[model samples]
Target: MSFVGKKYKLDKSENFDEYMKELGVGLVTRKMGNSLSPTVEVTLEGDTYTLTTTSTFKTSAISFKLGVEFDEETLDGRNVKSIITLDGNKLTQEQKGDKPTTIVREFTDNELITTLTIGNVKCVRVYKAV
Candidate 1:
């Protein structure tokens, strides 16, 4: 039913480097991001949700409520205002900053698929439950 309490490990990524480039990420950071496999854990507590992404480089934990806007510092070191909305099994996030982007995460068949859209670039990342 819910995607909470599950841990998903990054399986593969498509066009991730291009997407990071669109976000103005530097060469070194892009290479680091591309080389690392991150594990994402989603936890729900009433109306609040925590999404934790952990990798060899770093771990990022974000906590927010549905429809509430919060400040976020992206992995690439960009600060933005982000809001996440849940629709059925899909969670969509809009980050407002100098370079706005949209992220959509959908859970299906025990897989969490994420789509990142920035300008004309789109990247898909697949994660499998672990």
Candidate 2:
């Protein structure tokens, strides 16, 4: 996969803290989340794809097969049933749990652009390849 082993650094974000509040994330957690500029990497081995996110606060990773549902513990501590699908250069994830959320990651040659939506709130985060 072209994206495998490629790294992306968070360059900017919009309305992320508001989106976190919609998810019922606590104040402290939301503040930390807002301050974090994480690095993300995706890797593949055989049939499994692993996406890892790293920040000064913590590191989180999830592994799954495309189109298959898996249990996920989100960065903000939500336990979710998640599935990821791909179309062209966009990877879309749907998470069902206490609240349903949709995350879409669109990869371009120089950036990974992510949009998060939940409860009418949408947050966009741009990560430049480095």
- Candidate 1 residues 72-114, lDDT tens each? 9998888999999999999999999999999999988689999
Q: What is the per-residue lDDT of model 2 for residues 20-72, given as tens digits with 9 covering 90 to 100?
A: 99999999999888899999998999989899999999999999999999999
TM-score per prediction, in order, is 0.97, 0.97
Number of residue pairs clashing in candidate 1, backbone atoms closer than 3 angstroms, sequence gap of 3 or more or interchain: 0
Stretches of candidate 1 exceeding 4 Å from the true structure: none
TM-score of 2: 0.97
Each prediction's total of clashing residue pairs, residues at least 3 apart in sequence or on different chains, is 0, 0
